[model samples]
Target: MRRFHIALAVADLQDSIADYSRRLGVEPTAVVPRKYALFRTDQLNFSINQMPERAGQLRHLGFEDDAASGFSSTHDVNGIEWELFSPADQDAKIPEVYGKEVIRAG
Candidate 1:
């Protein structure tokens, strides 16, 4: 299976989480307090990161593929970054990017 992925920088993580949860009709799958949140649905893998300076901007675009062997990323001609990875790849990287202690399963 492959799911479209979207990552955005938001001014407020909590507010964004609430708003997105309502919009998506589901709560996030995982959240890192004051930092980030990730929501997964049948067709999408959406995430928001607390980034006031970059709020309202797209951080990147990607795909979550079950058959993917590892995580990889590249920039498009327009300089937009695109990533590809499996769920396990993301899980391994999350703790490295965001401290393990801060992540809370949702």
Candidate 2:
């Protein structure tokens, strides 16, 4: 089954990890390059990463499901719309910032 994920840019990995750990009651599953980390849960994958140089402000939000059938439903919601990476196909170039498998919807 597919799982939803959220990636956030943080300035301090350790502080963020500690705060999130105390708040969420879980530690990260992976830590890469001292600037990236991931926390997994039964229904969500939360990640933190360093922002790229010269990148403008960015915020991405989307959903994941075993099948690519909920985009339209979620899109119709009042404050949501089509994100750049939703309904990602097998051949889609998953962004480096994500650092996770983009499971194809069955």
Candidate 3:
């Protein structure tokens, strides 16, 4: 099964971790204070990092698929970014995947 991944940056790591844990009803799967924390549930995979520049902001969006082969990133008209990992032969719907053009591995 493919899982969506969300990564964020926060000013306060521990506090954010605690807050998310409470909200998600579970503890973080892994944490490295002042560095990062990771959480993975059946429905989602999340991570928060202590990056001063992007604090309190989303770092990126990703898709984890065991069958995926390469990667791509794009932005919508609203400017939200997304990254997808998929096999080359797989059919990727552009409009739905957040891109106006087909992105290839560089």
Candidate 4:
């Protein structure tokens, strides 16, 4: 299966991590110094990275699915549309897989 992680750039690593932990109700699995932090869920892997100018900005989005499965759909954020997928073809919609309320910025 193809698996990937989405990394976001933030200004305050600790603050962001804490906020996300509370919001997502899960602590990060790994924390790297001034570099990145990793949070792995059952279906998705969320990461935070420290960047100078683009802090608190959306870095990139990713998906994890079997190579054989076709791309399901895409999410439009700002003016860009991000392709989405699932670990299995029979799985629910993309928004259901990754919380629908989660905002994706451009």
Candidate 5:
């Protein structure tokens, strides 16, 4: 399973929520006033952040991987920050992927 993910900074959270809700034809999956919103459609998942410090900027860009091979980056790049929901198994080196026993380095 795969989904397209995108995130953008919004000047007005309420207005953006309404606009996206209407455009996407659905309400946000989660909404925190003056903070952020998550909109999910059939093929796209996007988040809108109410960024007063950096309005009209990209908040992040990336997709959530169910397999979570631990390749996703979770840091800032050129002032843009990205996030991913990693499985708890992420820290564990998946043996199936490595073809051998993997140990975590201290």
Candidate 6:
């Protein structure tokens, strides 16, 4: 399966998580306190980061693909970053990327 992934920067992590949970109709899969959150659904792999100055901005886009070889990222002609990774690949990178331990939410 391949799920479209979206990442955004938000002003508040907790607030965004609550709102997005309602919007997505499911709680986040993992969270890093006031830093980050990940929400995975059948068709969407969504996440948000607490970056006040970059609030409401798209951080990047990606795909959560089961058949993906490994985590990889590149930029498009417009300079928008895109990633291709499996769930396990993402799980392994979470701590390294966020520099904090994550707590599974649901």
Q: Using lDDT as the measure, which candidate wins? A: 6
Stretches of candidate 2 exceeding 4 Å from the true structure = 52-58, 63-106
Report the error of model 6 at residue 45, Å.
Answer: 0.4
Per-model lDDT: 0.92, 0.54, 0.68, 0.62, 0.65, 0.94
Worst 10 residues of 4 by lDDT: 97-106
Decide which is better by TM-score, 2 or 3.
Answer: 3
- lDDT by residue for model 4 over 1-106, one digit each (tens)? 5556576788877788888889767887656555556676676667787676888677767676667466554656665334445544413333453434333222
Query: Which of 1 and 6 is ahead in lDDT?
Result: 6
- Could you estimate the TM-score for every candidate? 0.95, 0.51, 0.64, 0.54, 0.64, 0.96
Q: Show the colliding residue pairs in model 4.
A: none
Candidate 3 per-residue C-alpha lDDT over 49-102 given as tens digits, one digit per residue, 9 for 90 to 100: 878788878888877566866676888677878766642322343223333433
User: Pairing residues by index, what is the TM-score of model 1?
Assistant: 0.95
- After superposition on all CA atoms, how large is the RMSD of candidate 5? 11.7
Residue 22, candidate 3: Cα error in Å is 0.7
Model 6 residue runs over 4 Å out of place are none
Q: Over the stretch 1-106, how does candidate 5's per-residue lDDT look in tens digits?
A: 4456788888898999899889989887656556767776777768787887787877677665565556465666575556554324322323443334333322
Clashes of 5: 0
What overall lDDT, based on C-alpha atoms, would model 2 receive against the true structure? 0.54
Off by over 4 Å in 3: 70-81, 85-106
lDDT by residue (22-101, candidate 6, tens digit) is 99999999898889999999999999999999999999998999999889999999999999999999988899888777
Q: For candidate 5, what is the TM-score?
A: 0.64
C-alpha root-mean-square deviation, each candidate: 1.2, 7.0, 10.6, 10.9, 11.7, 1.0
Which residue pairs collide, candidate 6? none
Give the Cα error of residue 56 in candidate 2, in Å: 13
